[model samples]
Target: MPDPEEPDVVSATDLETPPGLEPPPTAVRDLLAPDRRFVSARRNLGSFAKTGDAARLRRGIAQYVRTGYGGAGTMSRRLGSVSRTARSLSQVLDPGAADRGLDRALLQGNSVAEITDAVVEAACSSDGTLDAEASRESIRNALSDLLGLYSDVDLLRLTDAQREFVIESFVAHDVYRRFALDVGKHLVDNAPTATIGLSRLKQARNYIRQTIAESFRLLREAGQSMTTAHVRSTVANALTNSLVVFEGYLA
Candidate 1:
């Protein structure tokens, strides 16, 4: 008997071809022998990570430090050059430091750009002794670490439509929220023109939707599942970082 959880396999002969598309004859045979692994796997989204937000952030930070610092000698040397206040790199590279620097910035309601800058700076050099190249590398490593955490999820179980839906809803909510906030601020400021042009608003909406769709496609290609919490957090970060563009719709 077929598994109750599995979707019914439809024969290609019974499938109606959409307008303007002609499927090859082999398509029917291939459909009859679909990949069993994918067919049997759960199709719904699951939690991206089992840990809480703080723990997830700390794990990401620790991974970044370990991967970026290379060795204890290098870390020590970097720390020594960066600061005289601390005797060890652990003082700044550990989870406590992540809590103090990145977490603190987040809790203080800093923008995503500010938080990202702060986290990268704190990771690169606690006392700010890193040169431009080193700082840039640190920022790259920091973002990689954070994005890597979410990219670890298995996305093969989800259908393309499901992934698209999650991404679209996430982007829509973020755009709507920012648009509402900007309009409210304009009203409060008594601006000469409180209304944004419809064309500009449409452009902004299209840009955000395209961005979100492309981001989701890349993540899906990388085998990352789009969980509800992960989608929300990712969209929030995007909105926070793109506040200027989002607010530009008002102009």
Candidate 2:
């Protein structure tokens, strides 16, 4: 027979031994077996680059857990596990995540709840720390995504790949995303009424909204936890600060 340590049911929360209880790490390991890990990675990617109007990140994760894992039952169970883990982490809400989702809602047209839910999920799951390798990859990814979004050259410089890479790599991922989100939200919330044309106003709104959305998505997908508000305030206080080295790149 199998060793007594192996249990019939493997779960993230089931961290006890057979007949009694297993430990969480063992359960997480069993659940994250190579094949399961592959599935999780794939589902995560699906959450990132879907074609349809952006859906709530929370909904996407929940659905992935539900169907991709076991079902609604599994989602509830995993949620319980995640909730417990969340209690241990610091609780700074990133306004950028909220603004990014809100901007997306205004543009691609999702509900406020859907947008807010996604923002909350992003904020909660954010880790904000990327080592050298991941940071390099993130910089490349950020630039590519930005180029695709901007498609124009005047508003923000697109060259200086090396400088941009350095800025992105050295900066705190969550903090940068937070600031970008803040800038975007503030612009949207305080768009000048004196603007001449509807076209100008719409363009400005789209630009700010898209910028925040892209930054928020990048930050969340990278697993950084810094909120948009934090980043914004930090940058505003001292534009040359280490928290947002991007401004340094501009200089």
Candidate 3:
């Protein structure tokens, strides 16, 4: 029989009803409202918009992916000097610190918040400024709301179908947070705007989400076990395919 758990089985109208509680949000546009308190996330919004620096976005996402499946990954391999310094301080002074930091690289079963912390930490610009610790907090909230539905699922040992579902949702959620959380003028063409182009923003967010999700649909089947290395490979594929979506995508 066909694997009932395959992501393809879930239609657009489908809401993931996880056992006891109400269905977790499958359409996250409503939950993506920017946390204006996170000034750094706001800075991230404005900075990434102009530079077309998709790589930085990819790097942040890679951290989240690695965290889910245990990856001290190569995303940091090519970070420019500024980002390198930030990662060193956070990952080194923090992760490798003898006194109070991580004694080893993160392995499987790490918490999802590590995704937000790693992304925010790697993107930090200075030592103690909120610029590094922006008033924003969307990634954590969005991912928590969406992935929380799978609380019973063992992320490290997912079937291919479940793994793909997680990957697609992650890409969509990441893209959604970047845009949906832009409650400021960072993503628009003008200031003094009333709505912040909410319509266009929605169009863009949904479009990217759909695009990345479709990329995973092209796969043949969900046969493999999501081993650590397999998770790494798929995460890399997710990043590459996600970049492809952004290439034709605007804003």
Q: Give the residue spans of candidate 3 off by over 4 A.
A: 1-139, 147-164, 176-193, 220-226, 248-251
Off by over 4 Å in 2: 1-131, 152-251
lDDT of 3 by residue, 64-174 (tens): 324322332332221122222222332322322232233234534566566445534443333432212221232233335445677765432445444445434544554
Native-structure RMSD, model 3 = 14.1
What is the TM-score (0 to 1) of candidate 2?
0.20
TM-scores, all candidates, are 0.25, 0.20, 0.37
Q: Output the lDDT of residue 221, model 1.
A: 75
Return the top candidate by TM-score. Answer: 3
Per-residue accuracy of model 1 over 127-211 as CA lDDT, tens digit each = 3322322333333333443345455422222244433343344344333333222221221122222122222222223444444
Better of 1 and 2 by TM-score: 1
What's the C-alpha lDDT at position 188 in model 2? 23
Candidate 1, which ten residues in sequence have the lowest lDDT sum? Answer: 40-49
lDDT computed for candidate 1: 0.32
Q: Least lDDT summed over 10 consecutive residues: which range in candidate 2?
A: 14-23
